[model samples]
Target: MRCETIREALSARIDGELEPIAPGALDRHMATCAECRSWYRRASSLHRTLAAQPEPPVPDLAADILRHLPPDAPLSSAS
Candidate 1:
């Protein structure tokens, strides 16, 4: 795959969201492309940082948030 395509797929690849071809293409491109490798490192690092920080809502916390919504409001994904 081309650099443009690889760049587009890098984040998805890092997130394990890519189809098989995209991940393989990402790996192959990273091997030979320093720029993409650096991009992948930065993207991976940020993903890890953000992923680690979003503590899942405790049951009580979810309930509390839900309690504050309008009575007719649909329950969010939180509930």
Candidate 2:
């Protein structure tokens, strides 16, 4: 398989998406392709580090946004 195809499959594998490449084929390709192996290592490390962090709180901006709207403005302009 082409390196591009393998790299894409590696991304899907990392993201927990459906596995497209056969497991044996992927392992064999990675074993021989140093560049792909390096890329996968970095990408996997980033994925793990990001996944371990707690989600940041989402700010509630609805009230603040509504306050900025003009009083007479129509909510919807549909005829």
TM-score of each: 0.57, 0.68
Cα lDDT tens digits for candidate 2, 1-79 = 8989999999999999976889789989999999999999999999999999999999999899889999997778898
Each candidate's root-mean-square deviation in Å?
A: 5.7, 4.0
What is the alpha-carbon lDDT for the whole of candidate 1? 0.77
Candidate 1 local lDDT, 1-79, one digit each (tens): 6777787787667777844454565677789999988888898999889988978775658777778889998665585
Instruction: Give the Å error, residue 22, model 2.
Output: 1.4
Which residue ranges in model 1 land beyond 4 Å of their true spot? 20-22, 55-79
List the lowest-lDDT window of 10 residues for candidate 2: 18-27
Model 2: colliding residue pairs? none
